[model samples]
Target: MDELDEVLPPEVTATLTEQLAGWADGAVTLAPRIGVALVLLGLTALVAWMAGQVLTRLGRRTRLRRNLVDVLRLVSNTAIWLTGLLIAVTVVFPTITPGRALTTLGLGSVAIGFAFKDTFENFLAGILILLREPFRIDDTIECEGAEGRVEAITIRDTHIRQTDGQLVVVPNAQLFHNPVTVRTDQQFRRASIICGVAYGEDVDEARAVIEKAVRAVDLVRDDVRDIQVFAHAFGASSIDFEVTWWTGSLPVDIRASRDQVVAAVKRALDEAGIEIPFPYRTLTVNAPVPIRSVDGQG
Candidate 1:
């Protein structure tokens, strides 16, 4: 150490020591600023959360649609956080002017938008969905081969609870771009079933029986319209009748009504001696040739 110190000039060593001391002093001075920045960030997050809660509660109190309420809450929360972030940045860097900050943000946003194109696409789609409300929460919807009730809608995805109890998270872009079928959009939905009877049984009689049977189901609604029964097609085994009825739009209602209709139809057909025939196949063999003795043996 003494040899290296002797090789170096006294002036250079003194300059290096002074620079190290300045750096240490600068670090000490900046520590408080960094701490204040962290505190500002925490406060910003807290304020954003509080704003979200208030907006959500207020939205719920109004008559606004659920999706619209969520959207409003989201927008308000975002605005609050953005304001907080700007303030925190200004506090941290006292010399950065707001105009310069905005300009920098504008440039940064373009790069971020390109980098996260799909994410931004879903976000925009989600906002539009919340604004337009194609389907509401708990609405039964079919889209992209996934049939389920909407559980929740968020900025990036929609949560759907399937009939088999599976939860699916679908991107908002897919929902917005594709066609969705809302099965429970109306109060009543049409339920149809095909029933077949033996060809000998009268088609008109079968139709009458089916109409009566389906109408008798408690879940089936008869006040709006009468049940419709029509001869749909001649099947391989039995003549088919397409019976249509109005029922509650829910899946459970449709299933229960169908069960009742099927039971009632079976009972009515049995009582009336109308046979629901199964497919029957007939095979015939021509008279077999007389057996001949092998090797010319009679």
Candidate 2:
């Protein structure tokens, strides 16, 4: 120290040497702790992977829902990783007790929560949705005018495959807050279509014909519910019958059933001489107007 002071300023040399020695001691002491922390982290990762595999096998054996099993695995892995990290931190810094570490974490969480409010909201909503399970994977659902089949549900969002082959990722919060229509909640659903016949046709006969036709549709489930045909409204050129029947709940099933019913009803009405009239419009003018020919001849 005295020799270095001869070449350099006493204050600067003494401070620099003390700092260098302190850093060297810190490095020597911290090296083993860092190595231990790294080993612990590796063990944590290995354990997390093993836990995931075990949970997956248990889920399969127990026949649990796939989404629920995934949720459990995610939660378990997070907890294990957090525990390992906490232990590693304590090993490195003996001054930081578990209570102090937790308090610090609580303070940090407040800031993190504010930064990722939507993410946490969606995560909580996802957990709730998984528990409640109003609809399942492959079930058809409609929400906010978007209709599709549910392909997957995760901690953040849900995947829906639309009929036109588009994939929609909907946030769990939206689903939890809004009203969702589960189309396939039941095995069968009722469908209705307006069938109009000429005003001159008998209402009772038209109703009977529509009922018989709808019931004959292959996709129609008459065993579950009877087909119904009622006089609904009067049109300018025809009387409308509300033809309703029960059929499979899936969208494809309903569409196919409708096609068959429409074809059968048209054929039945044609055979019965009941004309399904088209709209007839008449224009009335207050003043008389002269008509002209395309060739300008009267």
Error of 2 at 184 (Å): 1.6
RMSD in order of candidates? 4.8, 2.9
User: Candidate 1, which segments miss by more than 4 Å at Cα?
Assistant: 1-8, 14-50, 63-74, 87-95, 287-298
Ten-residue stretch with the least lDDT total in model 1:
62-71
- Among residues 3 or more apart in sequence or in different chains, the pairs in candidate 2 whose N, CA or C atoms overlap within 3 Å are none
What's the alpha carbon RMSD for model 2? Answer: 2.9
Tell me, by TM-score, which candidate is best.
2
Error of 2 at 139 (Å): 1.4
Model 1, residue pairs in steric clash: none
Kindly give the stretch of ten consecutive residues in candidate 2 with the minimal lDDT sum: 232-241
Per-residue CA lDDT of model 2 for 94-127, tens digit only, reads 8998888889989999999999999999999999
Candidate 2 global TM-score: 0.87
